[model samples]
Target: MHPSFQERIDEVGELLQRTKAARSGFYSRIDRRAPAKPVRYQVVGGSFGMYQIKDLTTGKTRAFRNDYKAAHDLAMQFEAKANRQITVAL
Candidate 1:
């Protein structure tokens, strides 16, 4: 036999509570808030063999010794500051 309307409603309520959709607000805030800008770092190499780390948004560059590791480390530092849970592409 098919479930009654009340029984179906109760089942859906339990499912929503299990998924935490019963109190979700993330979707409602999307239209009211501006999208976030993604952080990006570019590693540029100089002619003199030195490495430069550039912040794409600000056009600011920091110089590092001719070692790629140093420039990569600088990029990682920027990533840490931007979002600790996410990593930046090299």
Candidate 2:
């Protein structure tokens, strides 16, 4: 049995709608996994003048004993690397 012209048009329209829905779902999944903001690092002060490198994105901290320069440098390095990753991901 042959499908009438109107039926064929309706089928094509339904297919188009399904394709759009599938594409949106795929992109939504990717967006959910992608970082909402660029990763950042900061040098935070701790007790007794101690310093630490803090990952602002993940809220993780690494301690350094009164070594602000080292902590700052490490934070900068992390931030740079994170920027590179974000650029590559985009």
Candidate 3:
């Protein structure tokens, strides 16, 4: 026998709720496998008031700067490079 109008509507609502739950579960699984954000570079003070840009992830020296201006320049250069890569990816 065909379902009444209200019965069909209720069945559809239940199916929609189940589909939404399944989709959310799938998305959560994908999110769990995604890579973490890249660590940022930092400029730290050294002896004699010098500065050095270091990669926070690898603890490697990226550049040495005699003053804040030079340090900022290096930071900007890295930022530009990252931005370019992002644009290219899209």
Tell me the tens digit of each residue's lDDT in model 1 across 1-90.
Answer: 456988999999999786655234554556544325445777888767788888887888855658889888888887677665666899
Clashing pairs in 3: none
Ranking of all predicted structures according to TM-score, beginning with the best and ending with the worst: 3, 2, 1
Q: What is the lDDT of residue 81 in candidate 3?
A: 70
- Please, what are the lDDT tens digits per residue for candidate 3 over residues 1-90? 456988999999999999877867876988863324443777888768689888777888889889988997897787567546443554
Candidate numbers sorted by lDDT from highest down: 3, 2, 1
Residues 30-74 of candidate 2 have per-residue lDDT tens digits of 886434554488788887678988877778885464788888888
Residue 86 C-alpha lDDT in model 2: 40
Question: What's the TM-score of each model vs. the native?
Answer: 0.45, 0.46, 0.47
Which residue pairs does candidate 2 place in steric collision? none
- Clash tally, candidates in order: 0, 0, 0
Against the true structure, whose lDDT is highest? Answer: 3
Better-scoring candidate (TM-score), 1 or 2: 2
